[model samples]
Target chain A: MMTRRIIYLDNAATTFPKPEGVIRAVEECMRYRGGNPGRSSHSVSVAAAQTVYSARAAIASMCGAEPERVAFTLNATYALNLAIKGLVRPYSHVVISNIEHNSVLRPVSSLSSMKTDYSLFDVVGKAQGDTEGVLASLKSALRGNTGAVVVCHRSNTLPVEAPLEAIGELCRKKGLTFIVDASQSFGCVETDIEKCGISALCAPFHKGLYGPQGGGFAAFGKSVSDREIRTIMQGGSGSASSEVSMPGYLPERLEAGTVPTPAIAGALAGAEFVKRQGASRIDRYERELVEYMKKRLSRFDKVKVYFPERSCGGILLFNAEGFSGEELAAALDKRGICVRSGLHCSPLSHRVNNTLSCGAVRASVSAFNSYSDVDAFADSLSAVLSLR
Target chain B: MKKCYVSMSTMTLAQKARNILALNKIKANVVKLTVDQSYGGCSWGVETDCDDQEKIRRILDISDIPGYRFIRGKE
Candidate 1:
């Protein structure tokens, strides 16, 4: 009996069929160590806390962060919100990339409505071989009151990446905080906190780290002062109870309320998986798939691929002539190819790629995806194009 | 400065207490407890010098870590 595997190309949204040992760790945490971390010093509680700490350490080690400074959030959105709202004060100016995801835009927009001013730097220029042009755009966007600069490591709408290290250097020279939304690039790319001058690196454990959903982390660097990065949400931190005010610490300062222990447990195993597999190996495997997918699928006249120059992550953005992104994706779906169509919660990315009218189709692969899976996608795309 | 043990309900809180003490200039080491010292399979605690025990106790009180009772000591 042969059972066919569903060709999932939506790793950008979330990694499906999570890597091995992740499920077992989640189940084990819920069943065996069912105690509240930091609430007390009971054996079960301490054990649970150890598991969470180990996960944090694993994630931080990979991100080039100190374990104690990494704070767990409900998801990357929460982490991003914490970073954005925590940094921007009233009347502060900020700079952001033009092709940011909604996670970055929505929170920054909230600040805009309040009083903070912001300017968007052109990142599409970097993708078009204008590296110095991108740097100039970022420099031009900065103002005297610019307190922070936010950028996405890679665009979700395209396979293109922003000049993060350059932006980090700019932030350092300007003495402004640099925040990176690493949702689409963390596990597949290296984000050294110090080298990149990242004040806070926000990402979900699921997408690239191959961890569970509902778990996100933000690793804060030394650039974020305890006084500057204030708390947005405050409750029982389980660390400092004697004072009415929240405790002034790295993780405990940011984290308040009960954490998602089960998710953290799963993330522990997932981080272990990433560590064992190594980020470079995963990047190499995904790059191979992306290369194969691009070469095989682009020969069709109807297919117009964007960011084909990318050799980093496993993401392909394209449009089929005479067919809308939604329609093309639907046809692919019928062929057991799971892909994301439309804005992908990132309207600005479409605007940057000149896909404002009809959103582009995204087929993002994971390390687990093989060459055969990509071949299936290409074959299905060709068959669908011929039908049209 | 006699070395002693201060056990909390959870390793997370114990580690926190140790960090706080260090920040306040009180010396302490966080370590996994020996099997004989544990009723359960595994246990961890802060090892502080007796000279700083009162200081650590005062700091812990100020921390207000919930349900924080000294599980064991006097080893």
Candidate 2:
């Protein structure tokens, strides 16, 4: 029996049908270049280390940072945890946005036990593309003891984009460290760490870069010294082995144990793919598809589109009149249509959008998705909702 | 020609140093130090035939490569 094709619309969780180059890179790394990086001096090990270095350089170049400043992790959550738990002072406070994922929310919430308090600032005027409201709300939320400002660059469930430049400027003016969670925005948006004055920009490769899971990074800016950010996990960094503590540098300071070489090699290819295709070109195309999806789905009377004006063109959220988001998703799933439903591991966003009760259905697009894919998804969703 | 080893903290740094030196008309090989030469269990360095400490130091300083030490010995 031939396997039915899946219509994957869950790019926010992780992009599917990765680029051919990315898949080939991973296979080649595992087949021919399988060696322990940064651990030995053998030719095989040296070659592996070189491949990893190339990946680091790619990630750094994309973020406008030095190669040594990028530290690899399992995913964006670990990277965000490193940035938040590492930078926030014990007695100081932090300011975060209202639509943060649990990655940011849980870490900040956990920090409260250590007397590290946090406050939330709404991304005001996000729908209108106005930064002044966000700046004003952020200023109002600031306290004298606020040492860091963490914001999600894009909401995973909605298209809410926090004003990075405005928030970065405010943080700089207030003498605060700015940490950005770019989990949902990295490859889909253009970002320059130096220009934006971001202290640490954390993101994963699986979601937008079209790489396999198990690889992510936190790229630190020049303003952040090695000693300023502490290490949450410590192990053999393949550097300064004699020292009892972790190395006093970037990359090695935060990166402990063995990094996933195959995953990183694939991520490097993914980054290269994005570079070749042009991030702006990809963004424009995906936005067009999202606009088409929004218009097509809204033609049905029972479909109530949520945040129609707030989306930054990557993700769309909606619900049918009488069907819960989960039920609609289940019905669609039976038809081989893949979409995420419920809270989307982002209760904070649900609460803000008044979707905390039944949750919202999220259909995220990627550079690979086309108008046909969107049409199929709409037809399947319509069929699912009509059953009510 | 005398060969000398420039010890670096990590393999990434050693590789970076090799690339930097190559661009400046210098040839260097990344090598692993033996147990006796290894500072902390295992260490990495770049081996270069040009042993002029002053010239190498100047080049490294200009490139801003950090935390490297020169140890003179035969591999």
Candidate 3:
């Protein structure tokens, strides 16, 4: 007899079974518009460039920015690197949260040695109690030499939503650059670049955006001037090849070499899908599922759930004693339940929560997850607890 | 206060029952009935009167109590 698969609850890492149109768009790009975007005058090149432009427009609209201000990169990490390295000069100070992913941590760590000073505030403890703690930390950490304030819109582990507007206002008042890492909340939550006062935003096409994993982008808000951000990578921008150096422009200044046309096309389709479904609806659905899972997991005597009050995204962290996170995850995997068990690339967050050694099991949901999926997960967890 | 007693191997389940009681703000003592050697876990029975059964059920609803069942005492 064949047993049906129980459920999938790990969507924060990357969304699976992407929308049909997303796959279709990538296939179409590969088949029809397989040319270097912005590099040629042929019809194929124009078609590829148009596809990329369409994607940029969709992303810009999603974040409330001008389409020209958006530049494609390899992934959110790359976009963040460009923003971090390009915006901060030598002897500049930077502020970041402790709960940030390695994508932000590693780059900042390496850059700090090159005469850039940085301060990391522990936001995990405060995130559980107050959402504004992230912004308050950023404001307090600001110094005269502080050039940028980098933040993750939502912590990948706890699903805590940062106060982007307040942080943006603080950055504006202090004449500092506000760069946001929206890899977790880009498609799940509505982000208005103008309202949040964000000077720049870096996001991946995968994960919440529901696209392939190769494409990412950064959008520069109106508050930031073109001259302030230096271009780190200079190469063929496909337009100003006649010039000896990179053009002094918005996107072309940052974009180097041939872009990932297929991934960008897929991202456009994914963003369109999100637009049609509505970000608010997706946010509400995922939040309800997380709340339901938290409520159900709290019943187990051996299970310890960590759910903050103000979190509305998908991720949930918890642990069961007498069992490591890997052991609990393995038990659930036997029942066809999918979850991630680790520090989730944030060792600082785990240290703050005292889960460094065992690391809590993280079950993140997406809009595609159904209520029945949550119920099945709850049942499987119950079975595992019964064995304890 | 009425006292009920049962035997189980581990105190994890007992602690969970206590948490459920605290969440519901109910006052009662939960005693483990027996420990199953095969699973190395225990079976538990709630010892509240008919008046507190509904509140206990509400607690169970929110607590995610595992292997929960009502067992009426032999009168």
Q: What TM-score, over all chains together, does every model reach?
A: 0.86, 0.96, 0.80
What are the candidates' interface root-mean-square deviations?
9.2, 1.8, 32.7
lDDT of 1 by residue, A247-319 (tens): 6656776778889999999988988888788888898898788899889987998888887776657888899
Clashes in each model (backbone N, CA, C under 3 Å)?
7, 0, 2
* Local distance difference test, each candidate: 0.82, 0.87, 0.77
Model 1 Cα lDDT, one tens digit per residue, B1-75: 467777542355567667678889987666555555543333446887777767777888887644343434564
Q: Can you list the residue pairs that collide in candidate 1?
A: A40-B9, A40-B10, A41-B8, A41-B9, A41-B10, A42-B9, A241-B63
DockQ of each: 0.12, 0.60, 0.00
Kindly give the stretch of ten consecutive residues in candidate 2 chain A with the minimal lDDT sum. Answer: A123-132
Candidate 2 per-residue lDDT over residues A1-388, each given as its tens digit:
9999788888889999899999999999998888989888777878889889899889888889888889999999999999999999998899998888999999999998889899998884545677888888888999989999999998888777887887888788888999999998888788999999999999998987889999999999988999889899999988678889888877888988999999999999999999999888887888888889999998899998887765475788998888888888888889888888989988988998899988988888889888999999999887887786
Error of 1 at A320 (Å): 0.8
Evaluated at residue A41, the lDDT of candidate 2 is 76
- Give candidate 1's iRMS in Å, 1 decimal: 9.2
Query: Candidate 1 DockQ category?
Result: incorrect
Q: Per-residue lDDT for B16-72 in model 2, tens only? A: 788888888789888887656766657788898756667878988887788788888
Q: Residues B1-75, candidate 3: write the lDDT tens digits.
A: 333332211122333455457567766553445433212232334355555666776776675444445544443
Model 2 C-alpha RMSD to native: 1.6
Q: After superposition, how far is residue A343 of candidate 3 from its true place, in Å?
A: 1.0
In candidate 1, which residue ranges exceed 4 Å CA deviation? Answer: A1-4, A126-130, B1-45, B48-75
Query: What's model 3's lDDT at A44?
Result: 84
Error of 3 at A328 (Å): 1.6
